[model samples]
Target: MKFAAFSGVLIDHSIQEALQLTKKLGFDGIEIAAREPHLSAATSAPRVKEIRTVADGLGLDIPVIAGYMGGFSTASDKESEQAFSEFQRMLEMSETLGASMIRVGSGGPNAFLAEDYHYAKAAFWLRKCAAEARKHDKRIVLEIHNVSLVETVESGLRLLDLVGEDNVGLIHDAGNMYITDTDYGRDSVIALGRKMFHVHVKDEKRVAEAGSPGTFVNRTKHGEEKFLQCRLGEGEADHQPLFDALKETGYDGWVTLECHAPFPAYERLEHDFRKVKQMLGLA
Candidate 1:
């Protein structure tokens, strides 16, 4: 598997700068954040080509363009259409960026206990996105994130079945899984099997305090629980087992590092890179 750095960590810098930093930190590729100050649907085609050229020159592969397309499951008919239109633009940008895949999400509002209608809506929109991505010879991967329709391996598999497209896949994010379902190890990875097209490497530990929360804690309206992002070995997310399981599945895809810690971007990147390399026996 190839190691990548998500540009979201370097949101303060331009995409070109993020690429340069990623290469300097010994990453094999970059997962471009499809957001402002980096890349977006509104970015000019010429600029997109320029970024692609820069990445190629630096020997950085643009494996995936990460985007946020939440709320489609709960959106109205008009809203769903608008969301699909926006994602089509994102697929076009992904092509221009020379990315092999685009990251999407299952609809939100934390529909972990919603009815089947909500899931059907999410599946419809995701299948539409997958179709658009397939036309561009790119894959659309849904991240296994919390507060989404698919947070666990079982739910993710169900969504994939619902989408029913060969181009659709999942991104196994251990940190998010750890937050939601703490059993994100070999079993989960094996469950995903070939459906996992990419991986997001992050580590989080739940804070037990009553009032104070750490900088990395992700607090939401659901509760005051804290999932503090920290160094790979320092957190509760045991990624080595997950890596082992992925290896067993022969998943030769991008394993992108997502730094949510409150530290310098370079520091977090370098630290995660070293740790992941060690885990993969490259160190």
Candidate 2:
């Protein structure tokens, strides 16, 4: 698997600076976040091309464009249409930036609760997105995030089956599995199998006490507390098994490091990138 850095960690920095930092840290590629001070749907085509030129000049590949397109699965028809229109714009920008994949969320907890209807809605839009993506030689990937519809292996498989499109796949995030199941192992990887098109690497740790305000934390079904953002190798996520599983499955895709810890951006990037390299036997 090739290593990439998610630019969301450096949200305060410009896209140029983020790409520069990623390359300085020895990352093979970058996953651009569709947010402020970075590329977004509202960004002009010239700006997108400029960002692409800068990355190409630095020899950095932009493999995936990560954005919150989950709102497309909302109950409101008007809201879903607006969200999908924005998704199409992002998809166009991603193609312009030379990215082959775009990361989208599986709606939220409510979508999972209303499984049958939401699943069909998600499939309908995802199929449309996949068809559009194919026209641009790109793909639309659903990330397995907490509170998302496809947070588990079973749920993800169900959604994938519903979509039943070649260009639609899963971003197998072990950290998310840790947040939801506390099990980041080979079994999940084996279950995802060929449907795993991308990967997001992070770590999670359970905090005994309530975490600081604004921190991303969730409670398990049994009422245990877990923090989604933690220092690399300092959490419950065991990445070695994930690496082994990826190797066993011959998975060759972008493995982007997502640094959500409350640390200096460069520090988080350097530490997590090195840790993942070590885990993958590349350090």
Candidate 3:
């Protein structure tokens, strides 16, 4: 699998700068954060053309755009319509960015677990979006995250079933799975199989005393442990098994480097990039 740098991690840098550094660091591609302070829906047409030209010139692929269209779990009818309108614009942006997939989160408040959550409403919107994406020749991916509807493999599968769109898929984010399911990540990736259209790479250290009253803590089956974001190979997660599993599935795609370590942007990204190369034996 090829490795890419996620622009969100480079919050301190402009998109142009982020692209330059990603190429300099030996990443095969870049994942743009299609959100605030980066490139919102209101981003100008000229700016979109600029990013596309720069990425192409750098020989960098934008594999996916991490969009802000969280599912309509709790949005009002008007809000859902608004979100759909916004997604259409994002699809246009993603097309120009040369992204094959558009990443969508489970909208609304973060759920500690997948149970007792009414995902039908979310499914409705996902189905609509997935259908729309197909028309654009794009795929929609939902991240397996802590606060979202698809926190576990079972839950994620169920949601996909509900959406029932062929182009709809999941993003196996190992760090987020650890926080929500205490999963080492290999098993989940194996379970996802071809349904996993994309991935976000991160290694989170378990923090025993992270936040008060489980604000940021997940009452995982193991226990309530806070997951502290850290650079790859510098945290509790062992990515070798995860890498092995991805290859086993014949997944030859981009795995974006995304972490929330408190280190400087370039330092953390470079560190994770090297770690991924080492684990994959690319170095």
Candidate 4:
């Protein structure tokens, strides 16, 4: 498996600076976060060209472009339209950025808020997005997160079935899953099978109180679990099982270390990268 850095961590850094930092850290690739301060659809084609040129010059791959798009399952037509339009622009941007996958979200608690309150509408838009992505040979991967339509692998698979698009898949996020489930382990990958399009790595340990009320705390069969983001190995959540699952599944893709911890960007990059390398025993 190849390791990459998430540009979301380097939002304060310019795109070129981010690419340089990633290269300096010996990362195989950089997952570009397609949002403000880093990139957006408003960014001109020439600027994007410069970014691509710099990354290619550094011999770093752009595996995925993270887009903060949702609202497919909304009650309001305007909201859904805006989301799709943004996604359209992102698709075009992704084409120029040389990324094969676009990270997206399922409509979170807004409910998309349909009267029926089901995910059919979200699936509809995802199908359209999948078709559009296919034109560029890109895949649309939804994050397995809390408060979203796809809070679990079972629901995510159901959404894929509803979308019925072969290119649409799910990102296996162990940190998020650990918060949602007490037994967040190898079973997720085993269940996802080939539909596991990408993997995000971040570590969080169970805490007495996460400070922000109702944020990280969740009720599970094992009672309650509250979490606080921590350095990779220092966190209580074990990444070894997740890594072992990836190895067992023969997943040959970018295992991106998402730097969401409050530490300095460079420290998180080097430390987490080294820790993950040691955990997976990758050279």
TM-score of each: 0.94, 0.94, 0.92, 0.91
RMSD over all Cα atoms, model 1? 2.1
Candidate 4 lDDT over residue span 166-272, tens digit each: 89999888877776663457988899888989999888767777676323665543566677777788776688998888888788987898857778988988989
Candidate 3: list runs displaced more than 4 Å.
108-117, 211-224
lDDT of 1: 0.83
Better of 1 and 4 by TM-score: 1
Give stretches of model 1 more than 4 Å off. Answer: 210-224
Question: Which is the leading candidate under lDDT?
Answer: 1
Least accurate 10 contiguous residues by lDDT in model 4: 108-117
Instruction: Please give the CA lDDT of all the candidate structures.
Output: 0.83, 0.81, 0.81, 0.81
Better of 2 and 3 by TM-score: 2
Residue pairs with clashing backbones, model 4? 73-112
Candidate 2 Cα lDDT to native = 0.81
Across residues 170-269, which tens digit of lDDT does each residue of candidate 2 receive? 8888888877773558998887888889998888776765557325556455554646477689877888999988888888888999878777889988
Clashing pairs in 1: none
For candidate 3, what is the lDDT? 0.81
Worst 10 residues of 1 by lDDT: 210-219
